[model samples]
Target: MILKSPFPAANRFVTIQATMNKTNPSKKQVVVIGGGVIGVCTAYFLSKKGAAVTLIEQSSIACAASGKAGGFLALDWCDGGALSSLARTSFNLHRSLAQELNGKEAYGYRPLNTLSLSVTESENPSRGRKQTLPDWIDGPVKSQRTIGTTETTAQVHPQLFTRKLVETAVAEYGVKVVIGKVKSVETGGGKVTAVVDGGGVIDGDAVVLALGPWSSKFTLLSSVINVHGVKAHSLVLEPRDKDAISAHALFLSYQQAHGGQPMDPEIYPRPTGEVYVCGMSSQEDIPDDPEQIEPNPDSIRVLKRVAGTVSSHLGEQSQVKAEQACFLPCTDDNVPVIGEIPGMKGCYVATGHSCWGILNGPATGAAMAELVMDGCSAIVDLTRFSPARFVKRRR
Candidate 1:
């Protein structure tokens, strides 16, 4: 298992070469920005490869969307393609890590069977909506049609999972973690030399921009790092009885109308004792910071209405415990960018996972470690996630 040191060791300092003047040659320094799930996991992988790594976070670790996400993880969510390969590999890794590093208990990892449901309102109410509902959705009174099933489908308490990963990265691997705001990347001849943060310049051999939604604005990092933010609202419902919901993670795409507004809501049940119900998916720029994004009232109402349809066993509207809004970082093509930035040596990007950041974090980290240490990954091909794809499109 990989881990990091709580304190920076004396040997952490590398000797600079005379000819290079300021560049360290004896030890490698890697600076990873953003302390979200992706950032922390990346730092963990790099540190395990013997690099003197420092992770910097703008706020408390995982305090943003990473802390509040519905931690649903699926092994076959991306079926029959490049993304499927990555997601499948990632799911396996998450399962192994959960068992090996005490991550399962720490993050509330549990296997679940997932079900997808949809309800249809008749185009003509007089025609009877029940008869109009698709045959695929209509089953004997007791069961719904099975779109798919995986006993390995799982979830983790994202907040605790992120914290534990960071702690493990620091306590066992000698990584230096700092709380600061990164102003910019200082580069010389298109190669990153240092990362400018609150304290001062942190000299490094490589700089990884894993800042989630915030990464979209730092275009100078690389023309390849084109990212956007998708704002979503989620509701946390408190079930009066803990066993009210089944052990399965149910994904419902039910039609809902709240205050005369119509919407489709998706629900994800977690092992952490919280049920996540969400709807609104909007492409909004969270300019200042992710934490500044607030849940829109309209979306909240829609989510509540949708939750009411599926959470009948959880309890009434008053049982709702919390409301949350978060931004998901995405690329134009709706796939994550995990490889190095085009034209910028020593610079890398790992954002753009959108809603799957938590699910893909470990796979991305392991791939990044292979790229940085062994020059390639054998577990999963990352060519599809390369930053160069975006650069070519711009041209």
Candidate 2:
């Protein structure tokens, strides 16, 4: 478990709000647990909407999947599915946010020309047909096709983006950051309290459980629905000719020499002059702590091979920036479970976006704030993502 990244922490009641406890008697006090993008965004929007927000985390911000995962965004990738509206709404919101937050300079926000390609490591580069792929992609390319244009695709530095939201929320919106793990959510009378691991209790009018993959570890949530963690690996590489790597994002069907099974790896070139490659995934027991998570060496090695097979610039000449693993939260139904928890008024859970967490973070946060503060969300329809859908199945 690594405690640090190229990124970076907070304390309880750290912000100077109107009051030591509630901040403002006129505003709704909302406590959001988990400091991942989902939770941070929730806190951001809640505070932006005039709610007194307190965000609690066990470790540094973006230390888990939020920081480790590749930050790819698409407008219609979730089209024809339950996530279509949410994805679209979030896509648009990301654009507006980029303009408002100086996202290009703050968090590496930019539109991308995305592609899908097939590469065989053993195949001779000269034996293949002339590829119309980007020049930097000088490898054993077998086939290529344009999957996404700049109009419908974009990306961000996930860790940077998440951290930026938190910074804005704290500096401008009066959102408090608490550095502690939430033990449980308890409701007595009409108020809700978040019990922290160190005996700290945060009182709030409402509470959101954005525990990511750890949502399953909570009995109150696990009893209603399961949030399983899928361990995924990624590597950040700084190529020798960073300028040569375009802003194109690649979705590849990669095969090594004497192939066993073709691997589906994805690549994204960042504005920070580095490229990200990710692929190898498996399911294993999620550890009790995010800090306990570690990438499998074999998976890391295979990802390196895949990166080299995709482009020479990312081959031996490239420097590895990060080799890490994080667990993506996924549900059995394959749709994110949002909205309030049944029978527990003012208690909500938002998790299980899987790989789309970064793409969908803004809308999720906006929708959650609307739902929590206005009694329903106008940002996007939350009907399909309700946790009650599973509660009905449980019945």
Instruction: Please identify model 1 stretches exceeding 4 Å from their true place.
Output: 1-26, 120-143, 148-152, 189-191, 197-199, 257-262, 315-318
Q: Give TM per candidate.
A: 0.83, 0.95
Q: State residue 92's C-alpha deviation in candidate 1, in Å.
A: 0.3
lDDT of 1 by residue, 238-335 (tens): 76655545656555545433334435565666665567777688877685655576888888876775565444444363378878888888788889
Worst 10 residues of 2 by lDDT: 1-10
User: Against the unseen true structure, what C-alpha lDDT does each candidate score?
Assistant: 0.70, 0.87
Which whole-number lDDT from 0 to 100 does residue 230 have in model 2? 97
> What is the C-alpha lDDT profile of model 2 across 233-304, one tens digit per residue?
999999999999999999999887987898899999999998999989999989988889999999999999
**Candidate 2 — number of clashing residue pairs?**
0
